[model samples]
Target chain A: MTQQPTAAMLAIGDELLSGRTKDKNIGYLADAMTLAAIELKEVRIVADDQEAIVEAVNALRARYTYVFTSGGIGGTHDDITADSVSAAFGLPCIYNDEAIKRLAENYARRGIEFNESRRRMARMPEGAALIDNPVSTAPGFVIGNVHVMAGVPQVFQAMLANVIPTLQGGVAIISEAIDCPFGEGDIGTELAAIQKAHPHTSIGSYPRFSDKGFNTQLVVRARERALVDAAAIDIRAMIAALQG
Target chain B: MTQQPTAAMLAIGDELLSGRTKDKNIGYLADAMTLAAIELKEVRIVADDQEAIVEAVNALRARYTYVFTSGGIGGTHDDITADSVSAAFGLPCIYNDEAIKRLAENYARRGIEFNESRRRMARMPEGAALIDNPVSTAPGFVIGNVHVMAGVPQVFQAMLANVIPTLQGGVAIISEAIDCPFGEGDIGTELAAIQKAHPHTSIGSYPRFSDKGFNTQLVVRARERALVDAAAIDIRAMIAALQG
Candidate 1:
């Protein structure tokens, strides 16, 4: 069987690192990529430094099938993701005519002046394709495998919606969760044995402790439903044996 | 004044990457680190793969003053963080007597069997010191510059409380927020000029759009209060000019 298309995310901003902002994009992108059958391999959140952004972009782009970046695409001085991405790809960051025209029209309709700073949104790496942004007219861009989108949660999500459908995806990974009455310490041994027995499927045990109670949840995941089911059965039996 | 101690975070687990769990630790840690006067430079989330964990651990540990890791420290099969940390440091992973006895007593008091799988939590790189986990008895460990903590938010926060005081920190970064009536597009030009003028500080303008309304929040951050205040004064004057 062929490997699924893999993705990595670069969240660029000082606001996120300074704890002034909580990240809404990583979880959103992870959930979206999982549903699209594109495996999200890694995610890196870096400050709005061009060197750091360029380094992370180059590293992840070389490894993953696709690299999606969120944040740093606005009109302000800190919005340097587009230029950094261009540097990563060794291309000149340019103000594309199509993007500039679209953005100009959008601003003109709203009676907002399309000033030089506002026009900065139209800058993209040379030979890049635009990703549609329905929420706002400032389009995200795709250069090579890197997709640079907006930092705002709504805009990032909207641009991602337009990007996911275009990517090639493989079989969806299925997951089954069985809640064990006992804790992870109680079932960790047999669970390891079961996971070793079914090498193809991946098993993860999560212990939940809340005001309600404490219980262990065993998650089984695989591309094929049969493999996931097979591992899940052993997990249930392991819990049952502990009860017996 | 000397630079603040820099830190990087590695969030490890398949559950996080698969979107089975939305991470609460990164934001919490970022907030805590910022308050402690330690700069959190970068954060990476990787699956529970040993090679990935080892590589990230080494890379971050090499660059930053401290490397804090969350997740993959439980008793289950997927908990490979302890072993990976040992590999990264080229040390032997062993069950420390102090950690083992502490965990054993905690389980014994709770009338739970301290099985081999439970004892697995005591495994840490050689010459590592234990970080206290008051909520759960399975103590996290600190080896060299890396501090390994639990994945659960409650326990991770608890463990971090114990670890933070031991580290050295510098001057706190002061941030001042000025709420602008206009949007980012309206102020991006003058904002850029202000940011360029105050090259020593970082100025970020975030657009807020909700049922309440649309506004831009301009944040100024610097190690010294005067730099931040001066920048804020410039930012406010610029906004006033825009209104005029």
Candidate 2:
């Protein structure tokens, strides 16, 4: 069996760190990566500072198969992802003629001037490939295994669509969720034994407490469908026994 | 001026990384910390992995004044946060009699068995201080500067209330926002000048595109209210000039 490709996500913006903006990109990327059969192992949210962005990009890209960064790729003064990504790789960030042309055409269609600030979106790290943004004209870029994307949800999602097809995917992970109306304490020992018996599958027990009362959701995940099914069956039987 | 008390947040759970759960704790903590005059510097989301949890805990605790971790403190087999935190500090993780007493009493009142799995919630690192969980009976703990809390939103928020008051805070950061009906490219240069003129303040321009039209919200934040207001005035003037 081939190893699944691992990925790490970096969410960059002061808005996120300051709680001025709630991040929507991480969950979107997580779901997309799961469907693409990529294992998103770690996610980090950092501010707009260039040093922080460079440090996070270098660390994540080294540790994972692919590193995806969202935000700090706009035309504003704080949009420094391209510069930081370039610094991480020791590459010169320069304006690409193709990006410039695309931006100019996009602005012209909207009857707006492609001014210097908007023109800033044309900049890319040397040797970087541009990721298309269907929602907006400003293009994201890929330097090595790291893909830099816009912070805007629409642009980020569109850019991801352009990038996902270009990557290699492994076996898709299969998951099964069982709602068990038992507390974690009631099922902890039996759940551990079930987890031990099915070493191939990863079982997660999430306890939910509401006015309706305490309930637990046992999520079983594995690369093999048969293994997930087997583990889930045992979990169901255990829950049934506890209730009986 | 005293340095602002900085914090880092670690959101631990496979559910978050797998997109099965959307994290609410990070944003909640971020806003609470901001209001309390604490700076939230970084946030990380990692799966239920021991090594990863230990590494993140060690790194954040070393870098920031306070480290807050949410999740993985439940009674399930996958709840390994206490063990990982103990390993990070090289401290022995043992069941605390006080915590056990509290859990037993709470369970007894509810007519629930304080079984081994539920008993697991009483385990903490040696010499750790307990943080009260007002919502749930399971108490979180503080070992050194790291405050470990539950993954459940209600429990996490309640634990945060207990933890926030215990920390020393610095000067409260004041922020002002101005909504500009202009694209980022149109306001980029002027915004950069405004940011440079107010060196003590951090200016962030967030662009929004919708059916209403392209707009930008310029957020100016600083430890001093005067400086933030000053920056916001300049930004508002720039927007008015552009519109005129």
Candidate 3:
């Protein structure tokens, strides 16, 4: 069996840290990465400070197979992701001719002025590949393993679509869930044993309380479908025995 | 002005990393910390791995004034927060008699068995203080500067209420927002000047696209209300001038 590709996400913006903006990008990227057979192992949210961005980018890019950063790449003063990313890799960030042409054409077609701030969006790290943005003309860029994307959900999603197809994928993880009408305590010992038996699979017990009273959802996940199914069956039988 | 008390948050759960659960705890804690005159500096989301939890807890606790961790404090096999936190601090994790009594009473009152898994919630690092969980019977614990709370939204919020009042707060940050019907490029230069003028304040420009065309929300935040208002006035004037 091949090893699964691991990824980390960095959500950059003062808006997120200050609670002014609730981040939607992390969950979106998490699901997308999973579907692409890339395991998203860690996620970090940092403010718009350049030092913070550089530090997080360097750390995550080194630790994971891919590091995706969202936000701080727009046409504003706080949009420093491109520059910070360049700093992390010791690369020079300059305005790319292709990005400039794309932005200028989009602005000209809309009859909007291609002002300095708008032109700032054309800047990319040296030797970086541009990630296409279908929603907006401003392009995201990939430097080394770090993919810098816009903070806007529409643009980020679009850019992700462009990037995911270019990467190598591993075996997709299969998951099975069983809703057990019992507290975690009633099924934990048995659940642990099942987990022990299926060492390759991951068994998670999530407890929820609603009008129906306490309930637990046991999720079994593994790269192999047979392992997931086997573990799930054992979990179901254990829950049934505990209920009785 | 007094240095603002800074905090970091660690959201622990495989459900979150797997995108099975969209995290609501980070935003809630961000807003709560802001209101309490604390600045939330960073947020990390990690899976149900003990090593990940320990590393993040230790790193965040060392960097920020306070480290708040949510999730993994429940009665399940994946609930390894207490053990991980103890390991981070190099403290012995043991069952607290007080916590055990509380759980036993809550379970007995509800006619539920205090099984071994449920009893697991009573374990805490030696010399840690218990944080009240108003919504659930399982209590959270605080060891040193790290405050560990439940992963469930209701229990996490309830524990936050119990924890916030006990902390020392700094100068409250005041924020003002202005909605301008212009693209970020139209106002970026003037916004930069305004930000420079108010060195103590933080000005963030967020762009949006809707049927009404491009728009930007300029948020000005500072420890002093006068500085925030001043920055907002300059930003509003710049937008009005640009529109003219």
Candidate 4:
């Protein structure tokens, strides 16, 4: 809370690596981190291997203020992220009583038995805190700087949103978008010039698939809304003049 | 083709690192590489800085069989990916003749003027072969093992699909999924046993957001469908018994 928090996201899944599923957790976390004024520094997607998860978690935890990981927290064989992270921190994995009760009660509401495998969801590293999962009761856990959560995009997102608000924020996000007909090269040099003119703003250009045609969406974001809007207006005028 | 085809994905943009964009490119490329039988060992997401792109491309090109980059190939100021790749390869980035012709023709059909900024899309490293873009006219290019493409998920995906058929494939994808009611801990020991039982199958468990309650989806993947299926059957039976 003293210094601005910077975070890293590690997405663990072989399915993601094999392209069986599009991992949307990273984007969801990124947006949430930005909104909380926490800087999202790096994201790594590694296969669900203990060594890989351990290595990534260690590296990110050392470099960034916090590490937010999604996936590999399940009861199945490959869900080794929590164990690996616990190992990295030299912490013992233990069953969290609070998490177990919460998950069991959630299942009881649906008249479903909280089986042994389901009970495994309650395990957390010693000295860890449980992250609330209102959408699903299998609570994400925080150990040291690493927060381990479900890989399911929706659930992971919900958990992250719930957690991020409790963290301290430094800046609010303000951005403006300009739909430009100009292709990249024609406006490349001038755009570069404009960026040099405004050192504080973060300029982004996203090429969108539009019905009208391939259009470039140029966005300028900053802590200040007026600066963002001004930059966008100027950029839009520059694109129009280039077309003329 | 002569060597074990290797590929790496370079995701460029501040949005990604800032947590404004959770990247979909790495997962897409990983799957595409696996299907192509190409070894995808590493993927790095960097800010849209020319130096960072050049350094990453150079480092990856030396170590990898292929380096495919996404983002920064647009008309805006942050669209410096093409230039950086050119710098890394020590190739002159010129307004590609064929690309210009295509852009001009494509723009004419859409009744839009081909402005100078738009012409930036035509710039490519000297001697690079253009990768087909079915969804958009802004074609990606391949210089040696480096394939530079768009950042937008849909466009990047379409370009990947187009490029994959031109490459060789490794083992065909074969997989099976098992639903587990048990929590991760109770099945952790048994899941390890199942993995040991079938060393060839890539067994993984994903926690899904479920209406009934939190459930784990266990998947086994291999070159042989029957082998994968057999592993999944064992995994399911084990999970069921363990939960009971």
Deviation (Å) of B152 in candidate 2: 0.7
**Superposition error at A177 for model 3 (Å):** 1.0
B1-244: candidate 1 lDDT, tens digit per residue = 6877999999998888888899998998897778668989999999999999999999899999999999988888889999999999999999999999998887777678899899999999999999987556789999999999999886787677668768786765667778888876688888899989998676755454333445656777677889999999999888888889
Native contacts kept (model 2): 0.81
A96-153 per-residue lDDT for model 4 (tens digits): 9898889888889999999888877887788899898887788899888788889997
Name the best candidate (by lDDT).
2
CAPRI accuracy category, model 1? acceptable
Ten contiguous residues with the weakest lDDT in model 3 chain B: B205-214
- Candidate 4 docking: what grade? acceptable
Clashing pairs in 1: none
Off by over 4 Å in 4: A1-4, A101-115, A239-244, B1-8, B15-44, B50-65, B86-139, B152-158, B171-244
Q: Which parts of model 3 are misplaced by more than 4 Å?
A: B171-244
Q: In terms of TM-score, which candidate is stronger, 2 or 4?
A: 2
Each candidate's lDDT (Cα)? 0.88, 0.88, 0.86, 0.77
lDDT (C-alpha) at residue A124 in model 3: 80
Chain A TM-score for each of the predictions = 0.97, 0.97, 0.97, 0.89
Tens digit per residue, CA lDDT, model 3, B1-244: 7787999999999899888888998988887777668889999999888899999998999999999999888877789999999999999999988899999988887687888988999999999989976456678998999999988776677677668768777855566768888876677788889889988776765554344655656667677789888888888788778878
RMSD of 2: 12.1
Write the number of the candidate with greater DockQ, choosing between 2 and 4: 2
lDDT of 3 at A207: 82
- Where does candidate 3 chain A have its weakest 10-residue lDDT segment? A207-216
**What TM-scores do the predictions have?**
0.85, 0.85, 0.85, 0.71
Count of clashing pairs, candidate 3: 1
